[model samples]
Target: MIWPPTRPAPDPVRPGEESVWDYPRPPRLEAVRARLRVVLGDAVIAETEAGFRVLETSHPPTYYLPPGDIAAGTLVNPRRGGICEWKGQARLFDVQGGGKAASGAAWTYPDPTPDFRAIAGYVAFYAGPMDACFVGPDRATPQPGTFYGGWITPGIVGPFKGAPGTMGW
Candidate 1:
């Protein structure tokens, strides 16, 4: 599902320049689903073996998922909100049932436009708070600072978005 009348296109990179072509693309959106289960604590979060895309931004790419696949029960409405020009208004969610029950843990767009409708109601976690997060075969680990979730897959190199030296780029 796509959204927003004016979605931001990927930046144009010059040939042989060390451009971070970090934007992700899924072969098939339905092929992936976030499987949620307790890892080391009461928190239940989703992991997908199928493919998903991660975009390049100041923050990490927001992982998109099918709405039916997310475990909605684990989320509680958060008072905070934000806006994305490409998507729409976003609402936050707190991770409940986890050991850290009141954590301002996740976010979603319930009524995004047609472009991003697939991710509507599908939640993405901060990765900092989740006990574990996985993209495909790799386990996601918390990146330094409060910012990123490393979807550590083989052959993928860093420093990913929020890492030290790459901060200003």
Candidate 2:
């Protein structure tokens, strides 16, 4: 198992919360009812309570919002593409709103693995490059570094995977 049972977890996690270190190796997809909101510049680019979260070891939850709930024409122009070992190929997008744009700041998996089929038409934004993303009243902190799009809230703890010396994690 990737989780070291003998390795003392960093923080004391309450009964109902999770520690990223103890998350599963293959990751899990779960429905999220938390009000998810994405902002870029002054515009509320996307907002939805119908979202999904992918939970994996050493990473924070990456929220995926439903397309219908997002603002019209917010995601325009296809950019590059990426491959996730677990989720399959993903198409990137340019998010333009409030007179500003973040190229390839968001992505979607049109055809995903069977395990991730529920999120096929959903979008996940990189909170680091976005103006803000909120889960209910608390604003999220983007997962550390530029490569991963996990959204970090106060509930999650990490020596999160994407930091300077943690790439091998």
Candidate 3:
């Protein structure tokens, strides 16, 4: 693939909406007050009004929930995880709730790079594997592709990366 292939035209941004194309590279981590919720089956595995989101060019925001808000005993087993040049090392987890388990459904940054220190020990779940994830009252759709954990809410728009032939972006 080409290095930094030309990005597709972004969808029009309506009032109070954000276009993923406008986000910065190397990402910007910002604290958010929006209510975020995650569910699996009948269980509400996590919910928080206090969290952070990492925004990057061509990507939807990845919401990170504080560990305290997650259901006890939900995140289990630390599987080997990958390093992000920007965020530092991430440790993966298998999430179990409502008698169901999704392997590698969550991740945390135990000791993040200084810029990301605010989110150390906070967890981010992959919306695709959960029964549902929400940002406020709107349900979130998963960012395309299996590798990214971004939660795409109605307030966000994208011709996001992670689709076929878009890897270089």
Candidate 4:
């Protein structure tokens, strides 16, 4: 049988690094032991090690923190939501922490698609809405462009999705 071609080389990243270009088409959910934290205003609104990450080509990981790790009563009803073709429907939440409030700062899939069952009822925050989001010690950069919420950190390389002229990707 003929061998399937290997993926073309990604832009060079240092050892022990990840390239978003090499991530798969359908996206992969991987368990992470890294200490993930989300801070808004002066509060650590959420933190967890028992978290999962969604990795898709040309995108940084959008971390889903278990609702248990989030501060009590931080996420409240706001009647907002959106649809994800892959993950199914998402319900948006307003977060108030450390005396700050950002509407639609967090979202969850109450019933995700079969492939993303691990994150059902789990919430992911928009890095832009928070003061900072951390994977280990590095604070994350919000993914470029208005619509996407992937978190960019130092070790993840990307030309990335969500930029102008990249909608086709």
Question: Best candidate per TM-score, number?
Answer: 3
Over 4 Å off in model 2, which ranges? 1-9
User: Candidate 1: lDDT over CA atoms?
Assistant: 0.52
Candidate 1 local lDDT, 1-169, one digit each (tens): 2233223334454554222244443211233444432232544444444334445533334455544555556677665567766667877877755445546666777887676676676666666676666664456665556544334333443445565444444
Query: For every model shown, what is its TM-score relative to the native structure?
Result: 0.62, 0.91, 0.96, 0.91
Alpha-carbon local distance difference test for all models: 0.52, 0.88, 0.93, 0.88
The residue-by-residue lDDT of candidate 4 on 28-135, one tens digit each, is 999989999999888898999999999999889999999899889889984648898889989999998999999888899999999999999899999998999999
Clashes of 2: 0
Ordered from best to worst lDDT, the candidate numbers read 3, 4, 2, 1
> Which predicted model would earn the best lDDT?
3
Q: Give the lDDT of residue 73 in candidate 2.
A: 87
Q: Say what the RMSD of model 3 is.
A: 1.2
Off by over 4 Å in 4: 1-10
| Models sorted by TM-score, best on top | 3, 2, 4, 1
TM-score of 3: 0.96
lDDT of 4: 0.88
